[model samples]
Target: MAPHLADWRGRYVGSALAVVKPADTRQVAAVVRACAAANVPMVPQGGNTGLCGGATPLPDGRSVVINLSRMNRIRSVDAANNALIAEAGCTLAAVQQAADAENRLFPLSLASEGSCLVGGNLSTNAGGVQVLRYGNMRDLVLGVEVVLPDGRIWDGLRALRKDNTGYDLKQLFIGAEGTLGIVTAAVLKLFPRPRARATAWLAVPHPAVAVELLGFLRARCGERVTAFEIVGRAALELVLRHIPGARSPLAGDHGWCVLLELTDTLDAQALDAMLESAIAAALDTGLVTDTAIAASVAQAAALWALRENISEAQKIEGVSIKHDISVPVSRIPEFLERAHAELTAMWPGVRIVAFGHIGDGNLHYNLSKPDALDNAAFVSRTAEVNRVVHDLVASLQGSISAEHGLGQLKRDENARYKSDLELELMRAVKSAFDPRGLMNPGKVL
Candidate 1:
């Protein structure tokens, strides 16, 4: 119960009347029915690895939390159709491995794949490192099997590639953060496994240059460009300082670094050659300052480790005002410049650790506490900090919650930013699904 009551980052702690683990979809439907009959609230949780506290029960201690870990099962795999049916409780890593066993690829690669559940991924419509190439969970999922708020099962698990059927209703639950209904299982897309991958650590003069380099690589390599991540100097320094044996990939000091990887069905040598040729051209044009191209699979993984370990390293450092924001890909440089200027003007000595999937415009811009400030004092400024950051996001036509769904953290902020009509339509949809309002109350509406 205690483990299910809290979020991974320890930012949210809640209590539940009781935590229930169902063995299958039927049991989950039963639990929903009982809770609905009693007029008690229900919270559907998966791996509990969500950063936005979407899965944690409410603090009122009256809700019943339906934990889905025990329902972990890979129901079936259709290699011919390039799809797999996985229960909501299956770990993302397990699903990936299942695809690999069939010599297929499930391209949702997240830092928390080992712990995060597929159901949670669908609930939040998660975007990961490969979104630039593979898209997000919404694009990957072909169908879903949900337990409606009234305890009835809605089996919409048709693995058709194109279903012109009226009303794609599964979308209602995706990214709704469990406010509408509980997603019990999903039909996920798969792809042909790439035979070769080339990873690199590149130093850039600025974010704009990194953006330009991404375009240059895409022009030369086409769709082989898989991931392009930007890490600022402060973020890389944190990883190196906090993570043991996390050596700098490149020797010289760098203000900005890009973790770029290209994957293709081409042979290893050909793929490696393609990456090197592109990097060489960028270096000649001054788009790239310096580069460390990974020589082997292990080397590439080591490079990726530096990017993946940043959040864990930051958690070790201390609490911070963290924001998952996105702007247009072209406006990221402007956003970065303006955000830094405004934030520093508001509070001096704030350490801005800004980095993320620049190819997709999402940046995890975090403001760490100054060495002299206490945690309580810094955390108290969350609202002001959010205003400064979210206002900039709105101005740029960007989202405040990019990959992380809005649970208790950003529900009010969402209302403030969304138009009245948009909010009304959202609530109308919510009421249509969970009219009794028993499904994850006080979230995403």
Candidate 2:
């Protein structure tokens, strides 16, 4: 119960009446029915790896935390259909392995895939590095099987690619963060496994140049440009300083760097040659300051490790303000320029650790406390910092909670940016699916 009552970030702590682990869907339905009869709320949780505290129960101890760890199973895989059914508690890594066993690819990857569950991914509509080419969890899922608040199973797990139904009910629960219902299982779409991959660590003049590089690579290489991530100089330094064995991939420091990857089913030699040609042209055009192409699989993984370890490295550094934000790809540079200027004006010498999937316009913008300030003093100014950043996001038609769902952390902040009509519509949907409001109360809406 104690473990289930806290979030992965340890930013939120909660309590629950009891932690219930159902072995199967039938048992889950029974537990849900019992809770419904007693009017006891429920918080459906999977893996408990969410950063937003969406799966944590409330401190009131009025709800039961339904932990889905016991329901871990890969129900079936249809290779011909390029789809697989996974139970709610199945680890994301397990699902990926299942796809690999069938010689297929499940491209919904994240740093937490080793521990995060597929249900949580679906519920949050998670986005990852591959989202630039593969889209998010919502795009990867073909259908969902959810359990209504009243303990009724809605078996909507159809694997059809073309379904012109009157209303797509599964979508209502996809990104609802369990406010609507409990997603018990999902039908995940798969793709052909790539035979060759080319990874590079590149130094860029600035974020704008990184954006230009992305466009240039896309124009020439097309969909092979699977991932394009940007890391600020400050971010890379933190990783190199904190993470063991982390080394700089380039010869010299630059203002910004990008971790780009290209994947294809073509021959490995041809793919590597194409990547080399692209990097050579970029160098000739002065788009890249320096670059390092991965000579082996181990080197490619090392380059990816630098980008993936940013969050962990920051955690080891100290407490700081964090934001997952996004704007139009064209406006990213403008957003960064304005945000840095405003944040620095408010709190001088605040270390900005900005990095993320620049190809998809999302950035994990974080701020480290200045050396002169204490942790408590810097953390106390969270609201002021949020106002400065979120307001700018609104001005630029951006989202404050881009990939991360608006759990308890950003629910109120999100309301400030959304219009009255938009909030009203969202509330209407909530009421429609959960009239009694017994499904994960105090989350999302």
Candidate 3:
């Protein structure tokens, strides 16, 4: 490789035969053709910040890594059609800013936006803060230009809102985690930038109460509810303890907390007032126990900083086992109650850090030792912990992986949860696109 191939978290280190940086789509096609001729597997890499080890190559050193960082380019911006065509290696933040410059919005957002690539986002079908309002990358995409496993280029980069000409091949690669092909560019949809945004932090008594308040707020706010994130008391505590200058919005510890935002095409102050009134009504109805509405832009950012910094704070604490899972929104309370009870009972004194996009039914459920322990010892029980949590997710008809795809991290675990019939179909599709199994081998499949 280019010295090394490491994941964003540095948990996965892989070796490749060589890392080839392609400067354009034609160069990407050439790289793919060469790899295909040699019957060699090709691992497509973007910004290399994926949490699921999706971008990391196998350790065998048999694959040629196709690094797309050099292909970063904004091909065109069609403000009239509300779409933008960009190369895969462009940072997500850059894309958002470019859209904003045109008075448009590309609302897919995550904490790693500053470093993550739009192509990687498309490959994982990334869901982020605005998933509730703008949907995931899959829904935001209009077309994709991909280098198929065999080196042929499928240029479906049409920026049309409606194209019912034939089967939508773009959808296959959107969330396939790069198993079938390497996405080089994409035509993505955009929206008019929200004229106003109102954010509030609320303290709730329980997960059940948080779920209720979400429904209540949505009933009043409708699609304007841009984001609804839930933070457990323990999660918030981790932030305050490890993240400097982090302050709790509420005075006392609550069982659960929500960081909510409402955005609309209206006056900023009016939207803020509307959000405040909604929270007040929820409090009157006992759906919310306490609340803190942002009074200034800086104050609002500080509140978000706390929620966004939880992952980093936990990392500072120590190594921990983590899961990205999702269940029905209505079943979130039951999932949390049962998961916590069973995990705590099994591993007494285990610290469970549960928090994430409750509005989208996804949770970043994590576990760490209550006191200092060998990292190896803590990691050894990952399978046992996964058995309990994923089994429960299976029973609830939920997903073992929510936003993060089944990269090397959960490849085998996914085999356990997904039915043979389902996996067979997935394999069949993979074969249809890549009979040689060369594109991003050992991932998703």
Candidate 4:
């Protein structure tokens, strides 16, 4: 119960009456039945790697935690259909490996892939590095088997490419954060394994230049532009200081760096040539300042490590106020410039560590505590800081929580940003599916 009642970042700690692991869908249904019969609230948790408190039970200790670790299984693989069915407890890495064994690719690659479960990924509608090309968890999932709040199982697992029959009911549970129903298993979409891969780290003049480079690459390389990420100077320095063996991929202090990857299924040489040509042209146009193209698989992984270890590195440094935000791709430069100007004006010497999948318009904008200030004092100003940031996001027509769902972390912020009618419509949907509100209480809705 200790691990099940807390989240990955330790920002949220809770208590549960009991932590029960159900081995399969039937067992999960049974547990939910007993809980529902007693009118006890249920908290459905998977992997516990959530940054938000969506998986964390309430501190009241009145709820039963349904931990889905024991239900790990890859039910089936339809290689011809480019889909597979995996139980909720399967780690994202395990799903990726299973897909690789079938000569297919599961493109949801996250830093926590080895530990985070597929069910949690679906719950959050996770966006990762490759979302620019592959889309997020919502797009990758074809169907799901969910255990409703009343313990009735909804088995909607269909591996069809076209399912125009009525409502797409599966979507209700995908990013609902288990407030509506617990996703037990899913029909995950897969793609052909890439035979060619090119990864490069580039020093860009600014976020706008990086955006321009993405458009340039897309025009020349087309859909081969698999991932495009931005890493701030502050984020890179944190990784260098905290993560062992992490080093800068380029020389000199870069204001911002882009980790760009291009993948193709057919020919390696052709993909590499396309990337090289694009880089050469961008360099001539001053769109890129410096570049380090990975010459080997090992080099590519090393380059990726600098971007991946940012969260862990920040964790090692100390507590920080973190934000997972997204604006329009065109407004990214404006957001950055305006955010920096405003935040710095409010709190001088505040260290900002920002990075994420800028290709898809999501950025993990976080602020580390100033060395002169304590954690509590810095955290105390969260609301004020958030007001400044979120208001700016609202003005730009951006999202406060892009990939991460509206867990307890941003529940109030979500309410503040979303319109009254929009929230009312969402609540109507929540009531339709989970009138009892026994499934993962105090989350999302």
In terms of lDDT, the best-performing candidate is 1
Runs with alpha carbons beyond 4 Å of true place in candidate 1: 372-375
Q: Candidate 2's residue-wise lDDT over 28-64, tens digit each? A: 8999999999999999999998888899987898999
* Estimated TM-score for each candidate: 0.99, 0.99, 0.98, 0.99
Q: Please, what are the lDDT tens digits per residue for candidate 1 over residues 413-436?
A: 999899999999998998899898
Candidate 4 error regions (>4 Å): 372-375
Per model, how many backbone clashes are there?
0, 0, 0, 0
Model 2, C-alpha of 434: deviation from truth (Å):
1.0
Q: 386, model 1: CA deviation in Å?
A: 0.6
Instruction: Write down the TM-score for model 2.
Output: 0.99
Regions more than 4 Å wrong, model 3: 1-4, 374-376
Task: Give Cα distance to truth, residue 74, candidate 1, Å.
Answer: 0.8
Candidate 4 lDDT tens digits, 1-445: 6888889899899998999999999999999989999999999899999998999998999999998989899999999999999999999999999999999999999999999998999999998999999999989999999999889999999998898889999998888999998999999999999999999999999999999999999999999999999999999999999898998888799899999999998588888888899999999999999999999999999999999999999998888888889999999999999999999888877888989999999999998565736656877889999999899999999999998888998987899888899999999999998788888888886
The residue ranges of model 2 lying beyond 4 angstroms of the native Cα positions read 370-372
Backbone clash pairs for candidate 2 read none
TM-score, model 4 to reference = 0.99
Error of 1 at 66 (Å): 0.4
